[model samples]
Target chain A: MEEVVIQADKLTKKFGDFTAVDAITFQVRKGEIFGFLGANGAGKTTAMRMLCGLSVPTSGEAKVAGFDIYKETESIKKNIGYMSQKFSLYEDLTVVENIRFFGGIYGLTNEQIKNKTQQLIERLGLTSVQKQLVVDLPLGWKQKLSFSIAIIHQPKIVFLDEPTGGVDPLTRRQFWELIYEAAHNGITVFVTTHYMDEAEYCDRLSIMVDGRIKALDTPKNLKAEFEVESMDEVFYKLARQATRAE
Target chain B: MKAVIAENISKQYNGKPAVEKVSFEVDEGEIFGLIGPDGAGKTSIFRILTTLLLPDGGSAQVHHWDVVKDWRAIRNAVGYMPGKFSLYQDLTVEENLHFFATVFNTSIQENYHLIEEIYVQLEPFKNRRAGKLSGGMKQKLALCCALIHKPKVLFLDEPTTGVDPVSRREFWEMLKKLKQQNISIVVSTPYMDEASMCDRIASIQSGSILSIDTPQYLVKNYGNQLFKVKANDRYRLLEVLKSVPSTKSYAFGEYAHISVEKGHQMEASEIRQHLHQNGLTGVEIGDAEVTIEDCFINLLH
Candidate 1:
């Protein structure tokens, strides 16, 4: 059996009178591409923040990368990478400068940062514009570069929150190729997205609604369980069922 | 006569052509869509048509008034909802509506009939600040403001991109009702499924138009025999299907959709049998219909 890279039992989070994530339980296997799906304000961001150790859970037990999230948050931080929905990068910095800055923050040697930056720039076909400011780059290139910078530290798991929110379909397809490569290299990827079609690309996924996981399984299994022909229909069935249950 | 016209409209940013040599028209009372992703010139086109920005090379006319020569007349005769939430967040829901109407030298009461259906939803929250409303509600208020002026033509840029599915459906229903009022509507969206809701769409990519047609016509012209196949081990099944000499395959839904080469004479049963022969079990295969996303993917390839 594959080893579990992330494990949570009765994990919960709350802000004031509202519960953002409620007693969620699941396991993410090593090297798995796990999709985290939810509508706006459905607790996906909160759940991901807890997993990445950016926020402490209100109550529950969880482990990430073989370390307890509550007691070993610093370790968790060291071993995991995170990219938010906005592609948080310095827009005024050049492409190469952005990579160097991220690499520096991660405490890489100057030579190491330079070498990796070169390799990544070449791989992404951004060699020509490495010196150009990020704000001047197109949206697609910025997304790809942000993703590469996130994993530059060689973290065990990378948390991506809606990494391709506004990109074109063609660029999104290429972004998934990079993710597939990361997973193949034994890096676990936890990604959140609203796009149902992109959900089909994951090895497995969990759908959240109103601070709870409404469905969890492979895309194929979820579609079969819902008896829907596409993920969009599956999402609609689940979301409507969730609303009705409430 | 066309309700809207653009003659070689183009815009440049620091010597780079953001909108290059693009021109299109919208007939009166027609629903036209500008389909593309972020930075695909959809917003640029909308801004030029709405008279918010002057194009470098072309002239545009809305409701028989030149976009440049008669800017105020064009603004008064058309409604525009920009991609971003540009409403006054500090104002109450009712205040936003009244302010917009007042800007057009009209009152909310004067145009109550024009916005009755949409305004009714905001009635309960008339006292709430615009910032406090949810994304869907905020969208409705923006639509209400844009229509309060009673414009003959409407321009919406990516209005439903981030909205929830239910809200998106509601918004489109509102658009349909507005279209029935004989308002020529031009909207842009990144969602391909929404293309079917429009009378016609221009599929755009990298600042260029790929195709312009009705959603049904686009699918009808897809020209592929698509099949959905599944088995016990899906990953292995995908690999096996890809290796098939006469098959071009990709994962779609719970199955791998494969397009067989012509003259191969392979039936679904034969494909299933072949899967069984390859040490796979419980293989199921059947013909499948194409979708807008599929058409877009095919076009991209």
Candidate 2:
């Protein structure tokens, strides 16, 4: 049996009187690419933040990579990586400099940071522009490099929130290839995306609507249950149903 | 006559080509889409056509007025809603609408009929700050500001990117209504699903045009038989389907979409029997239609 890398029980988060995440429960298998789907303000970002140790949950219990989210958040932080919707690298820094900065922040030794930066630059085909400013790079390349920097620490799990929000189709596909490569190397991945097609790339996924888990299954099962031909239609059907229920 | 025309249009930023040798024409009353992702030069194209930016190479004419030579005339005849919200944050909804109308030497009451349908939605929020409105409401207000001038052409760039599903549906409906008024539309979007809503679309990638055609024509020429299959162990089922001889498969929801090689027409029963023999149970298979996303994936492959 596969190990459960992430476990949550009735996890809920509320801001003032508004509940962002309400009594949600789910588990992710080790090394699996898990997708978290929801519209804007549907509690996906809130849930991801809680799991990443960036934000505390209002109630319920959760574990990430076998460490309790409530008490072991620091340990959880040390063992996981996070990349937000916007590229989180300094625009004024050179490509190599940005990598070095992130590697240093993760507490790697100078020699280790240097070696990893070289490997990353070559692996991502960024050698030619290694010295160029990040702002000078194309948007696609910037996103790819940001993702590389996010996982540079070799964390057990990496959380990505809308990593390809505004990118084109071709670049988004290439980004997924990089994600799959990481998962193959035994790194668990948790990602959120508004694009339904991107959601289909995950090993398993859960749809959140109105601060609740409406559906949780592999992409194939979710579509079959919804009786839709594509993830977009599945989302449409689920979102409409949620509205009608309200 | 073409409502909008471009001749070898190009744009450069800091000596790097942003849009290179791009040219397209829009017919009167037709909805033309520049379908590409962020930094695919969609915004550059829109800016040039709307007379908001100057092109380094080639010339563009909107309603027979050159973008550079007759900038004033072109600006007066085109309505543009930029990719980013460019309205005043401090201005109220009604105030913003009135300001734009005044800039064009017109009044909200003078051209009220042109924007009546869209403006009514903003009526309730007339006193709300433009920045305080929801994304969908802000979108409507920006559009109203663009149309208050009663322009003959419209240009919208990724107008629904961050908006909700309902708002996106409603926004498209509004565009369809606007199209009926004989105002030519040139819109850009990264979403492939929106391609079908347009009369015609130009598929762009890495600053190049891949294909341009009507959505129906594009789908008809997709040239693949997509099959949807599922079993009790879906994760295992996808692996088995991927290894099947003469099959190109990918997981789509609770089923895997498989396209068998030419001359290989396996039925649903055959697939189910194969799954059963492979230690999989409760297998289900059925025919599936191609979607815009599917076609886009095929093109990428």
Clashing residue pairs in candidate 2 are A219-B253, A219-B254, A220-B253, A220-B254, A220-B255, A221-B254
| Per-residue lDDT over B165-267 for candidate 2, one digit per residue giving the tens place of the 0 to 100 score | 6557768888898889899999887777677899988877656677878899988877777788877765567667756777677765445778776667777
Q: Candidate 2: what lDDT?
A: 0.83
| Model 2 segments more than 4 A misplaced | A66-72, A241-246, B90-95, B105-138, B164-166, B205-211, B221-301
Evaluated at residue B198, the lDDT of candidate 1 is 92
Candidate number with greatest DockQ: 1
Once model 1 is optimally superposed onto the true structure by TM-score, how far is the C-alpha of residue B216 displaced, in angstroms?
1.7
Q: Estimate, for each residue in A1-246, the C-alpha lDDT of model 1 and write its tens digit.
A: 999999999899989978889999999999899998876667777898898888999999999999988889999988998888676799999999999999999889999998999899999999899999999898888989999999999999999988886666667767877887788788999998777777888889998888889899998899889997778887777665444111
Q: A182 in model 1: Cα distance from truth in Å?
A: 1.5
Candidate 2 per-residue C-alpha lDDT over A164-245 given as tens digits, one digit per residue, 9 for 90 to 100:
7666666776787688778878899999877777777788889888889999998878878888777878777776655411
Off by over 4 Å in 1: A241-246, B109-128, B132-134, B224-251, B255-288
What DockQ does each prediction reach against the true complex?
A: 0.33, 0.27
The TM-score obtained by model 1 is: 0.88
Per residue, candidate 1 scores C-alpha lDDT tens digits across B110-221 of: 9899789888878988999999776668888999999998889999988876666656776888889888999999998777767789998887766667778888898887
Docking class of 2: acceptable
